[model samples]
Target: MNKQAQAVVMLLFGGAIVRASLTDMYLRYVKESLRPFLIAAGLVLIAAAVMTLVHEVLRPKERAEEHDHGHDHGDGKPHREPWVAWLLILPVLGLLLVAPPALGSYAAGQSGTALSSQQISDYPPLPPGDPAKISVLDYASRAVFDKGVSLGDRTVRLTGFIASGPNGEPILARIILSCCAADGRPIKLGMSGNAPAGLANDSWVEVIGRYTDRTITDPVNEETIPYIEVETWTQIDPPKQQYE
Candidate 1:
């Protein structure tokens, strides 16, 4: 691409980034904490594009002189870019039109629950609520690492998309991201007891259950997969942000 076309591509790319960040579409790809940086990057790209276009217009004589001399580019009529240069717009169009959906059960199934490799300390007990709401990561750690002692007798509320267990049993899962979806992995709790029947994979649900001693080895990752004795569950719309 010529300088002008490159500038236009930068402008479009920057606009897509800014729009996605402002509208929460960026949450699909990155953590919420990176919003300011994303916006700033978009602004810088926009600024740089504007500067390049302005310089190109204000210094037409320089461009003409280079074209006449052919510079070092043999027989160049203002040195055209390769056809591949236009491919950069594909990502811009994808982001501007529709950001991809958040990772779901498919991602969870491909990689089993992510657990810490180091030995863990005893965890504090669940809070005072009858069905205390807790994050999937917290509950997974307490269940698998602390061995459910911290969850003893506590009815807990957990929310995540349904994933298929090895034997076709449904499991509750949340995709955990340290920074962005690129680094995401699943943390899962197998459903047992009164787990609602016929809950399909990828269905979003909120489950009420108590931790069970039951666990199975994850076939994919060969990690200890923990279980929850579900007392009740309800299907719900997918959350705005799917990762923990």
Candidate 2:
């Protein structure tokens, strides 16, 4: 490519690096899986820029004798080695060696659906004890569509972080998000039985519970809302991302 075209490519590559480094969204969604490839692409772009610079600097002058022999200026550029392009491989290799983790606690305070409460009356009740275990997302989504009537007295297990409610009580909560943690809304479930066992905020837990659809007035907001009443709760390790 010509100097101008090479320069534009270099600019784009630099812009991508800046963008990836500045925003967590791209790292959360786009760069996680393709980290190695992105690193490789960055290195390649850097190499291209260096090679273009070298070629521009070392370009040889045309010979007068060659012109007499019917030789052309050949686009006024020297033949460049494609192997020099491999210099781009360095960044990618580094990324491949050290892929970063996904978005984490740093985004806990962001505003998003991951932390929002859902309408409890919308979900079907849990069916009587069955072997097929369901996920918290299924329960939450169902709660959004229909009240937990279909879950009737069935024991459902939910796993998530132990976030504090408006009150001093330890609530088993999980952040449900529309996109990344930035949009996460907190959903708190009321644990029944004995008070949560040695539970602490941000700790992970698996709670087996019967879904009770009842509205409890929020002391902070003074608004009555629905919540899942827990039957059993067990503490466990916190997952990488509290919200998926």
Best by lDDT: 1
TM-score of each: 0.92, 0.51
Global lDDT scores for all candidate models = 0.85, 0.53
Summed backbone clashes in each candidate are 0, 38
Residue lDDT tens for model 1, 95-130: 888668899888988996797647575787687879
Indicate the TM-score of model 1. 0.92
**For candidate 1, what is the total of clashing residue pairs?**
0
Q: Which 10 residues in a row give candidate 2 its minimum summed lDDT? A: 106-115
Model 2, C-alpha of 1: deviation from truth (Å)? 24
Deviation (Å) of 154 in candidate 1:
0.7
